[model samples]
Target: MKTNSEKTIFEMSVPGRKGFRCAPSDVPAADLPEGLARGALPLPELSELDVVRHYTRLSRLNYSVDGGFYPLGSCTMKYNPKACEKAAAMTGLSALHPLQPIETVQGALLILHETQTILCELGGMAAGSLTPAAGAQAEFCGVKMIAAYLRDQGQTQRKVMLIPDSAHGTNPASSVMCGFACKPVKTNARGNVDLEDLARYCGDELAGIMITNPNTLGLFDENILDVTRMVHEAGGLVYGDGANMNALLGIVKPAALGIDVMHYNLHKTFSTPHGGGGPGAGAVCCVEKLADYLPGPVAAVIEEMTDEEPPVYGLVEPKKSIGMVRAFWGHFAIILRAYVYCMMVGKNGMREIGETATLNANYLMAALKDVYPLPYDRVCMHEFVLDAKWKDAPGIRAFDVAKRMMDYGLHPPTYYFPLIVHEALMIEPTETESKDVLDAFINVMRSIAEEAKTNPELLTNAPVETPFGRLDEVKAAKDLKVAV
Candidate 1:
């Protein structure tokens, strides 16, 4: 079942074929440094059409939001608008150099400033920094800012960071990177922070608590205000993990909920392209108490004139900042896309996004909850976890069901996550998917569940229609290979 397009470009390279033509050198040829050019170039020699066909075929193999449904849980795989892409790709912003003079790149700075302003308003914070490149980086920066603020206030003994058991894996890692000891807080049967556990963990050594609203299980902790109050009583700040901000946009503000700091995933909440390891921007915001400790070079209004002239926008460092977390600010193009997205979806539209996202998730969860057992049977925010232990079989598992999904021309929901549910299949059907698509996915899932009971082998040996059949994933990971 091997295809011609699967062959490496080098495998199809002819001896004397050339894909492109180059004019004779107009200027004098300069020699490369010694030892730089040693042997014949190891490059593919193919015709123009061959090269084009090879890449075109490769692109077809990728499953993206544009291709079909990608309901990756806790990731917010929503569709980004073409208008946002066009705004990001505009020559005036895209073509500007990073090192250009501030006066010349005022427009880009203005976009950054306005974006930060809107983010602060949404999060109910006094200030924000848009320099962290991704969600994880933003978490790291936020934790570091907390550490810096604590140190400045002579609270060196406050070194413990409390993270909920259902929080994302990055929360603890980020806290530890900032020299804080991580303490795991338990989740109750209602899928909320065990208030007793939180009270037990709160002490003089407690630095802060990192909690995700609409947490990984897609349930918002109803006791969030109480949790933050407990932490604050022990002289600790509350850090909100805004990875699930899509569920709270224009609905709830983290600062108003007693969260001292939080990071917004522009990719997840604002419809920027994500997955395949990034090109993302995380907008970090904080209350006035911690604003001075934010990462430096945040976009700000540098000058203002009375009567007629407008305010001059520029980059300025925080008074007692944690220095730069990244080089040359962050992913500017991604930030621009997020800014355009916010503008396109104004205040009312933002509320609609939150409502629709939650509604879609609940709808999908309701349709599939019968075939798959729901861990927390109540209403969900933007996603929910299901136990893939329905069939009374031994070998069939969540991974098997996920691989089988590829056969139906759909990407699988996140499997075995939050570490709380056994054989967890975390599902998040974003607002972008239509009812027809949701019904189709639901029917396919129901059919697969039926097949699991009737013919378990079909689930075990799945993805028969893909480029290749089931593979020994462990062998592939343990033993690596390049040549084919």
Candidate 2:
């Protein structure tokens, strides 16, 4: 049974329908160039009302942070404030072009400059560049800076980047892209980096370590400082993956914890629009030693503040800079949204974001641990991982539970990830959710556990209530059907 929303817009096209019809032209129409003219195009022809209703119905089929609970771990799919959206859409900011004169766009330049400063201050770094387009790009920029710094210091032998088993997959990829060989560091029983394993890899060939605190497993490394010290003592710079910055916010600074450089995912931590192949921003910050190698041009104040005149804000390329990693001055609209988020949250609220996110994750972890097996059973930072392999129902898996979640109208937590844990169901109930929502989610999870034991087939043939039922995922992946 196909739903009304399932029909493609093209399928609804009528022969002579028109959503809009231009009035007869007052001026003479100019003829197009020989190659520019086209015959009839295959666009859908529909009335204005038909188009609006079609899109509205189709939108209801999609899930969003605003629609319901999104417990996607490490991704931080939290509800962003609408006020930030309004700020980003403001005419003065949104209407300005990147090619506009610097003097004419002082307000935007000031915001960009202040945002860079704020990110550096928050991460405890001396300088930063808001030129990287996204978190992955920012990570690339950071690792490249480390490589440049090592080469400049004549330590070209530092070719190894030690990465923990629980680190985000991007860590090793970014290191390799920067020409550094990656070595996997083991995780201890307590979910922290294995100091013994890490120490063995620390040598003259060590480039650095790319660590994600409150790592992908949703646990903070207990021996983080020690780990960084070991690498630093071995003459290796530490590259912190700031994807988990939501868990630290105002609570701790990455640089103070021995991170030489890091990237801030504005989309994840700062509540900018996330996940939909974004116009995202990543602000990369570094200690004074590596500041010169940051990607340029970063926002900066060309002139000092004075009594009579305001300071002049401009873009500056750092000496020995890695050069432009992106077009223009990063994603301005996304950066503007982040700035608004920071200003609105304030200092105390920033701390609250970190604390409440931890509390929420712990709440869910404590509630679900009795049913789902928690691999590293301890207090989690801002997320927790669960092994969704129920011994009572061997047929049920994390993927089944995830699909079943859609039946309850809640988006599933990330499943089978961070690879270290078997059948991992990583959940991060961000600080934005209320207790009522959390309680409802907990109840739903408990019910799912019961169903897994009593009716294993229900778990296997999951998402019966959704628009689409459980699919043959492997076959779907192997032979995709993107369009109808």
Candidate 3:
């Protein structure tokens, strides 16, 4: 097989090729307006075979969770079950239009309502809204709810949102978007939030704190309860970023740990399709105090349940809702997939998901800690970060190691992220991966570490075995190209 194939559809076009012929019109041809007609339309002309083969080859070039081991840390890029996909594709569910009356789409409304109920029960929150498009939007919704609650209590002066230095980049962005000033909280030696520093900021001006439990460092903050207590005592709310919810699935609930409001990444925690900007759902849940301020059109049971018939489910706005954050019901298909995922996993399997994920992460961490320097040497929750800088291979960096992983036919773990670590190579072997696959990944990392010292040039000019060699990533970013 050829290593590289860069032919675009336009490039493969023939002068007068036709993939399909138009059927004869049943009615007479109508004339267009004076300015409506165009002399020519610029489109690729190719045979049906050529089009099919070209797209098929392109699809093969793309990497996915199904393709191989994707240990992208922070992002739980686990294998999505085919059963979820099948449920999402069901004609009874998929065929419904959003504009249909509530009575007509009762099944979908019930699924949405149940999904919200399940998420609330899992996160230990009172109520939730599954309207936010993705995690970031959900974070925004949570922040907005906090702002609304504060404003309602005549605490408009409380405008500061304390974010951890090791938080996802979206945390501060969400806070700012909600008209709150952001303050950075420091991380202690043990990777938990610095209580002393947090105490200093816990004043009337404090609106809340946005914390990621089992944070970006992939370690659960030991001082989480204290962090929340101080903020609450100071009359501020605590917003939990549940991006790493895979770790705490059934083991711990965010609300129990004093989180006033939080968002759950259905795409991450519930094994829905992730990536490609998405069709993602972020179900934002809150304590009873903030529930009324949630994003509108949350699924609810309109009519009470009876002995003979199921309860009537419908979309209802929270009493003091921040208003709709997304168009019509949000990503219904993604929500349906998540609903199916929860049903498939069940209660026992849900707990197992968390346990297995933590186990897999620790297993990988233990195997590679000697070869790669473990930054915060501790038990990681669901993912762990490692420093790629070695004394013997001083010149080799995390970027090189990441690129080199491609040569072994393995997708590289996230590198140069969470910003706190100097040369971070974060890895998360989600619960879906097997022991043999984890061992294979470990062997590849060991081989890469050895290659870094014995054959430094191999790491420098990495991915030589792949179809494309290492690229000028900076140039590719700055000099955008869209055409063939």
Candidate 4:
């Protein structure tokens, strides 16, 4: 609850009691622009405690994965080790500016270089670019590279990209963003990509196909080999959306199993703090053939035979590069965190992360299936999709279930996604969460099911304890604004 003495932003204003003091400017007052500042800025005035308390109260509203079991489907909100966070905050790397002299910031560069190398080996790609700031950006870069490669081969007619119905929505968004036509392929009842639909779309004009293995529904593509072969035979490249890489980190390599290029979301696969928005690192990896077209300036090592000092930064581009996607080699601090995460968990440990993630997800699926309807009943990967039909049948909806989760002091699973499933409740517990946490989460969900049957209103009129009740989503969507 808000304290009795608490003040809103407007209420906090005073005549003049600036908690944050500033020194006089070094520049002459007369040198300032005419209209820059004719009057004093109307800012908040409060004590240090007031400022701290106000912000701390605001921070409490956020339902973070670290705070509870957040099975947010494909987002993979795994626990980011505090040690990785500390390593990223190290003075040497975190304090360095991107524009600093190459020799002065070799440590940062070497970290990125080695991380790229490690990710390449882990994903079975020859080269990688740690430049795209997010997974979607990486997908955009990968798709653009596919377009560039096809355009160079005189296959300008090839402008359509094939994506599965079960693939992440970002697949089509990235495809269309690359200036190519987007074609959606259907998924089989078995929760795998419809290979027939993929073949039907395959042709000379098809640039590439993006597949998320252990896909959105949490089932692995049973015919992955045949699917890749079909795409390759059609003179097209294959790109894997590495969003589900958490499920394949050690079990399989997308590139080795016929994928040509892929993107790795550091925030998802690695131990980076997912800020729920920007500042996530998404590195793109590809084979040697595609290395020339990688976004630059990628980190490169230099030798110093002549003994004045060690050589400086190295950067090279091939014949048909996609150009710079972001300024100054992406988010170095986020990359540092991811690097620390990877190094902390070596090859064997990475495999364990994958294995445990898959095992936990499958276990959760089995535990909850009795109460919730499994859309695709099978052994899942690192996540599974559940249907809300039971809740929907008992006068309860997916939105009600999501809102009710808040009342139970639990975050809700991702709802209404993957498009193919109705009222999709995609859950991915991730390996970081323990079995006890999973059981507790399952119990809350199971309780909701029973409550929905007896006291349907309890679920429908849920989140009674939250600051905000059911949101008017349509109004919020139509009228875009956030409460102050």
Candidate 5:
């Protein structure tokens, strides 16, 4: 039933056409290594027109923040404002090389330094490192700092990181990457960490716990003060994952809640393009006690001619450092985008962002609760977790429901996550989206639910309108059919 539109790749491929030309191999040809080059390069070849049209079709298949209302939970796929892009494209910051001398790139450094200041104030921490290129990298940097701290204090046996079952997958993966065994803490009926279970794990051999505020399931940890008190009393540190910062932003500060360290995802919270950003900027902050172990090339204001000479590139040294996580500095352009977003949205605007985000989520929960089941019945922070167990009762899984959403011209909300709740659908309708857009999403979901009960087959084989049908996911992952 599918036609050229579906198989555009096939039409663009030509056997003997090359759009690019290079000088013929001029250097004397040496004996090649055994089995080095492939017998043929099976790249698709066509006139530029064909290639352009093919890729344009493929790009349309993707559902970006700019394309539609994306309620992807915890990921914060909210619209990255166009202003961020404009600011990042300025030649002074965007066009400069990372290796340019600090003196030469002082303008870029000042922007970076100002960003660090904002992160410190936002997280209520003593200092920050803009060197982490992504949230995962930031987490690794923070964990390594923890590792170095433990080694210095001669508590090398503190080799375990406690993660909540409702935590992001990166929490455990990052812990394992840092050479620590992971201990999973269970969630209570309310979706917060079970305090009794947590008490059982905090001891001499535990290094730290990775806590997500407005957790993956979109519920705040009401017991955070008690939790932080317990960890500090037990000689442990806490690492805050600020991936879901679109929720807390102005209403609360993580360090004020007793967190020692945390990383901010500028892409998620500050409207910086993520996938297209190439490399993101993560600002990691910590309490003064732990600041000495932070990763550096720390940026400080120093005297060039005097403390007055426009304070040039000033570097501070930590007594015990974890060394540098990245050479040169982090992505300057992306950080510039975050700085622009922050400055535009000052104190009250930031809090209003949080309030609107939370308000939108609550409205969405009300909009669809009749059709879907909510696992934890509570006031959600910036998102909410809905259960599909009721639909699964008749053999329809969350996976089926998700696929059906695509058929209705919407990107599906995250499904089967947080692990604590069976058949979880994590929906985070960020404040950027309006009531009308939210209604369209809810209506599509409601229609899918009705169809699920009356005709389950539609749910199984979905996205009928897209250029491609349901793919064998494992086959695509394990055995990608590349042309070459």
Candidate 6:
């Protein structure tokens, strides 16, 4: 909801007003290309103080990790440490141009090279390519590599990719983009993949199977080894969507579990800042068997010298590369932040992160299982899902509970996701959040549940405390009234 004092810059504009007073030009006027330039720009006119105040107020209105408890489920909206930001902003690394001479930016090259090494070790892969722009792009890279590998092996007819019913929505899209028809497998009542259904889908045409470990349902597939083995018997590879890697760090290695290829959301799992339309980094890691087919220009050690002299790092293409995914190397600053985060928290710290995150999630699940309907009433990895369909109060929905949270000054969990569960409210209490914060969140949710039973009108007309109440969401979507 908007504060009454806030207005669009345009609305606050006054004619002849100026934020700056520029001196008169003494040199000759510059010529413009014919029809290439415009007359006066339509920027808002305001004093410097007015512009600053307006932006400051707008910033305050936003919900941030720094401001409150943001349990945005699979997104992993944890607090990003300021140390990583400072390290990423260092001029030695930040100012080094991507196209600069290799000899000039040895330190920058070392950072990229070492970061790749750390990620490969962490994900239990022989090599890694940190060039994919985001998680879905990383999935596309892995699937495309599988396609190229199959083509090279003369298996042109192998064009079906099996994805589980509870897999990320991007998995099927990535498969289709890589020229593979998607065959959706079912999720059993226990939340693991249905082995019979998976076996039914596997055949000579099976290109690969893309599975999200510790899947969107927040349950680790216990029979993952068997799932991979079945795919192998059918002559198909396996791709791991490592978006949920936060739950598996230091506990299990995907490669050891027979995952041939996978991608890591460095921004989510490695403590780099994400969300709010910011840039992201997704490092694609592949096992030794598929190392030669990775995306090109992976950070590599070009030369080895004496102990006194450090090893030289440079970009080198894989044996059967898929060419460049992005223009240059990956997002350097994002990679730098993730690298710093890894260094700050060594192997033990990484293990602690996974453990604490899992414990926090289980704690919330135990506290609220009675208040809400727990779809899979088992121990969750790092998140859990709850249903909003109360038996007594039929129409009380997930949206009402979510909106009601806002009235209590708390950001709501992700709602209506994974597509399998009805009215799903996915909550991920990251390790960074404290027990107190989790307790408050749980209490708020419990209170909302009680309100749903006693007074359904409060749930229907939720977020009454905010400046706006009960938005026509469908109409708002079709006719977006966006203000510049």
Worst 10 residues of 4 by lDDT: 1-10
The runs of at least 3 residues in candidate 5 whose Cα sits more than 4 Å from the true structure, single-residue gaps closed, are 1-10, 13-45, 276-278, 304-308, 315-317, 391-393, 482-484
Each prediction's whole-model lDDT (CA): 0.91, 0.91, 0.91, 0.85, 0.83, 0.89
TM-score of 1: 0.96
lDDT, candidate 6, equals 0.89
lDDT string, candidate 3, 290-348, tens digits: 88898989888889989998899888888899999899999999999999999999877
Residue 64 error, candidate 6, Å? 1.3
Q: Is candidate 3 or candidate 6 better by lDDT?
A: 3
Task: Score residue 166 of candidate 3 by CA lDDT.
Answer: 90
Report, for all candidates in order, the number of backbone clashes. Answer: 0, 0, 0, 1, 0, 0
Write model 1 residue lDDT over 409-438, tens digit each, in one string.
989999989888889899888888899999
Query: What is the alpha-carbon lDDT for the whole of candidate 4?
Result: 0.85
> Candidate 2's residue-wise lDDT over 1-484, tens digit each?
6554677778777889999989899998888888886877878888998899987877887889989999999889989999999998899888999899899988999999889888988999999999899999999999999999999999999999999988788888899999999999999999999999999988999989999997888888889999999999999999999999999999899999999999999999999878767988989999999999999998888998899999999888999998899988989999999999999999788999999999999999999999998999999999999999987898989999999899899999988889899899999999999999999999999999999999888888888998679778898889987543
In order of appearance, the predictions have TM-scores of 0.96, 0.96, 0.96, 0.92, 0.91, 0.96
Give the per-residue Cα lDDT of candidate 5 at 363: 94
Per-candidate RMSD, Å: 1.9, 1.9, 1.9, 3.0, 3.5, 2.1
Which runs of model 1 end up more than 4 angstroms from their true locations?
Answer: 1-3, 23-34, 474-484
**Per-residue lDDT over 51-119 for candidate 4, one digit per residue giving the tens place of the 0 to 100 score:** 787778778878887677788889889998999878877898778888787778877888888998999
**What TM-score would candidate 4 get against the native?**
0.92
lDDT of 5 by residue, 105-128 (tens): 777778888989988888888989
